[model samples]
Target: MKGLILKDLITLKSYGKSLLLIFALFLFLGLSSGSPLSGAMMVMPISIMAAYVTFSYDKLSNWDCYACTMPMKRSEIVIARYFVTIILSLLFFAASLLSYLFTAVIMQNFSEVYLLIPSYSVLFGLIMILISLILVLNYKFGPDKARIALILIFILPSIFTALITQSNVPMPVISESTIMLFCTIMPILGIAALLLSYLMAAKIYQHKEF
Candidate 1:
């Protein structure tokens, strides 16, 4: 598992330049907006970016042949992909938080940023859910249709957020306490989703004839 994780991280080396450029752009946007929305926008694009890289391995490289020939079990390979996805998502997530913090500092409203954390936590949970769903859909339906499908899923969320941001209604009873409770419980759910995605990927890949 450790070896597979190391290998996956090493594979991301070539993507660093593109990722860093995106981060630099995100930092500028975050600083300009001085809002959590800037950070959220950055990660929203990156959730798909992470999925693209994680799955593109087999399609682009000779990795499928070598990984299958080795002692690593199919299940282990699936677990490793999910593990790497989680780690990268988390690192991006932390970057988003720091980006928002830097924005607040630049705006001279550092004290106002505490509220951003809860919203960021909820958004992270939702993104994880979407990522797992994307993986499963990609596994079952292939990538092209799945990519189109996820883009359509955004319409409803965009509408809901627009309405909430534009209206007088409260945010669905999600008080700070509820957010805290959710924050406490969400990581467990995220981990469960990660495990389930790994198992589903393993099941699909194990019997898939290469």
Candidate 2:
């Protein structure tokens, strides 16, 4: 399992320079706009993109077929991918948080930093759920078709949001307790989704003819 994860990390090493550039760009944007959340908002999508690139590399190299020939269990392969995705997500989150803090310091608005914790926690949970769905799609459909599905997954949300904004639907007012409850529940749900996704991917890979 360690070897499998190491291989994926090595494959992703080529992305190092690009990742740094993106971080610097977003950091600058946050500073210029005086909005730390702008930098933080990039975390989920960037992590997802990086994670998907690993899948693309695996497909191009026919890594799965070769992996299956080895003595490792199919479930381990799925787990390794999940681990890599999670590690990438956390790394990006840390970078975004640092950017947020730096921007807050420059703006002399450190008071708002604490306010971001709950929001960021919720965002991280949602990101996990999104990555879970991506993993299942990639495992079941292969990377090529999965890319199309992923595009639709992202586009439909934007279309729905646009419709909602055009309709001018009044947003509901919620109590602080309600918001806290939601933040608490979402991470638990995200964890459940991730576990289920792993099981589904393992089952798919088990019968998959590589």
Candidate 3:
């Protein structure tokens, strides 16, 4: 498992420059706008894209074929990919949080920073669900349809967010306890989705001919 993860990190080396540049741009945009959710917006896509990039790299390198010839279990490989996605997503979230904090310091207002906790809950859950969905589709359809799968992954989120944004319904004012409870519940659901995704992917890969 560790070796598989190490291989992904190495594969990501070539993509580092592009990811960094984009991350920097998003960080700048978030800071300039003084919006933590904007910072989170930067984090979510990039984190999901990182997983896609790794899978693309593996396909291009014929790593899957080679991996089957090795001693590792297919389930382990599937789990490793999920682990890599989680690690990269968490790292992106940390980076986004820091950027928000830096902006808060400059503006001398920390209230917005506290709001990030619940906002992050939503963002993180959404990303987990989307990432897992992408991975499962990729496993079922294979790399040949990966581009289409990626598009499908982004479409639902875009439409949902758009509807929420365009709606005339005013935002609700929830008490702190309610917000905290929501934050706790959401991440648990996200984890369940992630685990279920892993199981489904593992089953699919185990039966796949590679």
Candidate 4:
């Protein structure tokens, strides 16, 4: 898992500048607004781009065989990718907090909206986790045809929601006792998604001819 993680992190090297720009821009605007919602909005594209990077890394490097040959269990590699998603999700959550702090320091917000960040971050994290996992599944089924995975994971559901719901999804129906409900439930969902992804990836990896 550590090796797999290190390998993925290394992939970040090529896109570090773009990733930093995404984080900085979102962090800047989020802090300026003192709005978690805004912070979440800023986090969206970053998550999407990050997922793309995660999906594309191995095929582009032709490293699937190399990864399989390493001293690691197939499950470990999948777990590492899941870990990558969680870590990045947490990073975005932290960025949102930094945004809140920035706004507080700048005196740009009339009311503190720090609390709004977590739930929304969780929601976005869920989306990214599910999207990325499904991409892994599709890529597993067919190698060079992975481009379709991006569309299914990232675009199709969004387009369906937009087409059916007119680009707006309603807010959660739960009571806002505090951040705990939203934050707690989201991490649970994310963990579930990650575990499922790992299992599926492990199954696919073991059977994959590469």
Best by TM-score: 2
Q: Rate the local accuracy (lDDT) of all candidates.
A: 0.71, 0.84, 0.79, 0.64
**What's the ranking of the predictions by TM-score, best on top?**
2, 3, 1, 4
Q: Which is better, 1 or 4, measured by lDDT?
A: 1
Task: For candidate 2, write residues 1-210 as lDDT tens digits.
Answer: 999989988888866556677678668878777787777677877877776788899989999889999998999999999998888888788788877877777777665666687878788788888889889999999888889867886788899999999999999999999999988888888899899999999999899997
RMSD value for candidate 2: 1.4
Over 27-56, each residue of candidate 4 has an lDDT whose tens digit, in order, gives 667655656346546555565556556766
Write the number of the candidate with greater TM-score, choosing between 2 and 3.
2
lDDT of 3: 0.79
Candidate 1 overall lDDT versus native: 0.71
Relative to the true structure, candidate 2 reaches a TM of 0.94
With a 3 Å backbone cut-off (N, CA, C), the pairs that clash in candidate 4 are 31-99
Off by over 4 Å in 2: none
Q: Estimate each model's TM-score.
A: 0.79, 0.94, 0.85, 0.72
Judged by lDDT, which candidate is best?
2
lDDT of 4 at 161: 76
